[model samples]
Target: MMRYILVGILALMVLAVGLLSFEWYRGQNQAVAFGAPFELVDDSGQPITEKAFQGRPTALFFGFTHCPDVCPTTLFEMEGWLDELGEEGEDLQAFFITVDPERDTPEVMKTYLGNFSDRVTGITGDPEKVAAMAKAFRIYSRKVELEDGDYTMDHTASVMLLDRNGDFFGTISYEENAETAVAKLRRLINEG
Candidate 1:
């Protein structure tokens, strides 16, 4: 009886391993997918969609123009990285999507982004649409009321890297090392 029980356990273990291996193989063969559908406008008020992110690697950042530090710093860093990459990064695109659409309109976005590389475009639109887009992109954003009855925005500070097919590849933290950031961008360009 003990030997029979041991054999039964062995058979179950083999069956489990086979099932796990099949699932793993299926997952490996599945295509990678990320984010949801979104429709917004660029700084020029041009209708932009998820299709813009396709056909090339993209550096996507979400922040408000009113951002005191993180937004401006990330924009500057992005410009530098793009400049550093030169021709190699020509195919790489950068987009700045506003988390505070109430105050960051197309005009505001265009003027603000003017300080950075023209290669970097700004995206904004109706508040509800913008919120939906942000949600679909899995970005976190909230409004903070100040003592002056004013307001500020708290949002994600990382720059998301997307492959040529617009799949989420990785991210560069707000203060990620310059060298490391550049390396990640380089890898995205080459691999995507």
Candidate 2:
């Protein structure tokens, strides 16, 4: 009986160590030391700055209009969360930054975001400028050529959450549902 008790204690210690290691890994991955400030044109051609989004919780997604699967699904989920927020949703801002800047012109961005909530803002800028912003956000994107001259971009699908002070708070993976996403945002907002 003493031998069995010792083995159980050892197993529990191992499990505790594993759980702590996993949490540490997650914290390291999500840690943002510093992010560069950027200026980009919104769908309305209005200049948007990192300062403009300060004092409010912001959720940012990197995507393009031609995205075949991920973009639409993510946007739909985001819209549902916005709907759930109701009037207080106005306190939150959603930004869709296009990786395919060549084709995702301001006009294209405007049209693409039309179906969603009015709170959603689509942004695209010169290729070089967009690339710089993507690097700042630690977003990875690559273009794949098609049969025609057209091309498609594969980009990171993680949704970044920024605190009211414009600091990087955390990110919600694509696997998170609207409710989970909202819960995280609420916690961040309240904490700020």
Candidate 3:
């Protein structure tokens, strides 16, 4: 009876693995999608919104200029993927929206993003506006005080993708390969 029970458990485990593998292979549930809207200030200080993304698919990342690792790393990876995409990249817009608006003024955003891909544009605004924008995008962010009285932002590190119509597209994982991102962008370009 113990042997039979073990066999049953083994069979269930195999079935579970098979189902999960199939789901992964089918490429379903790859991202949490949102068609949310936002209003913030552009690098040039113009008021911006989803209207800016109407004609092209966009990748949006939320963080602050103070992030030491994940923020820059993700921006670099996105840059690499865009480089690999060539012209297809031209049809896409990339945004770096700041959660720490107090310190991420338009000028500060410009200088910070200049260190990364020029293809990306940075946006910031008042604290309330920033909070509303983050909420609209379903982004979670908060300020954390370090031991030295300095502060850093803790935020969701996911890259959000939106289609040309400013509709919910799919999200690209931080660990996703450049090829995957390129393929998704190509699909969006073709579909756009």
Candidate 4:
């Protein structure tokens, strides 16, 4: 009986150590996997992969057209920065990807994007594809049912910025100013 108890304690210690090691490895991997490879369609109906956004630094935002506030506000802010960029911002690409692929068709995207600058490309495709792309970027989004029986999307409100070589660069806050935003782009473009 004494021997059995000693062996059992040893086994439990090994198991606990193994579980801790696994958790440590997983945490490291997830942070490194951000902005990994993805394949999705653009607003133009053409399928775009991670490679398409290469050759220029890109800013990516995931949101829905029906969003009453943050989505449009963020887009508008980014558009202002892009517009003010002029020739300097030409090498920068801003993307507005839709989380609500069901209602945000290519036409709908174009019309909605029209209110913003043409520099921001709208991306939408099959629902599964959209979800996969969001996953690759580590974006969170959910559907909330409203009292009117309709629903709205609650999505991650941050924008991801990638370097010209398609590597994970940094992020842009919705409240960032034009000067700070422009500085980030210039740095990324120069780095490339």
Which one is best on lDDT?
1
Candidate 3 lDDT tens digits, 1-192: 999999999999999999999999776654444545667788778888778878888888888888899888998998888888887568888999999999999988888888887889998998997898788778899889999999998999888888887776768877677788778877877784
Tens-digit lDDT string for candidate 1 (1-192):
999999999999999999999999999866545677778889998999999999999999999999999999999999999988989889999999999988998999999999987998999988998898888778999999999999999999999999998888899999899999999999999993
Report clash pairs, candidate 4.
none
> What 10-residue stretch in candidate 3 is worst by lDDT?
28-37
Candidate 3: C-alpha lDDT: 0.84
Total clashes for model 2: 0
Candidate 4, residue 62: Cα displacement in angstroms equals: 0.7
Indicate whether candidate 1 or candidate 3 has the larger TM-score: 1
- Give per-candidate clash totals: 0, 0, 0, 0
lDDT at position 158, candidate 1: 96
Give the winner by lDDT: 1 or 4: 1
User: Against the true structure, candidate 4 has what lDDT?
Assistant: 0.85
Question: Could you tell me the TM-score of candidate 4?
Answer: 0.80
By lDDT rank, best first, the candidates go 1, 2, 4, 3
Query: Which is the better candidate, 1 or 2, if ranked by lDDT?
Result: 1
Worst 10 residues of 1 by lDDT: 29-38
TM-score of each: 0.86, 0.80, 0.79, 0.80
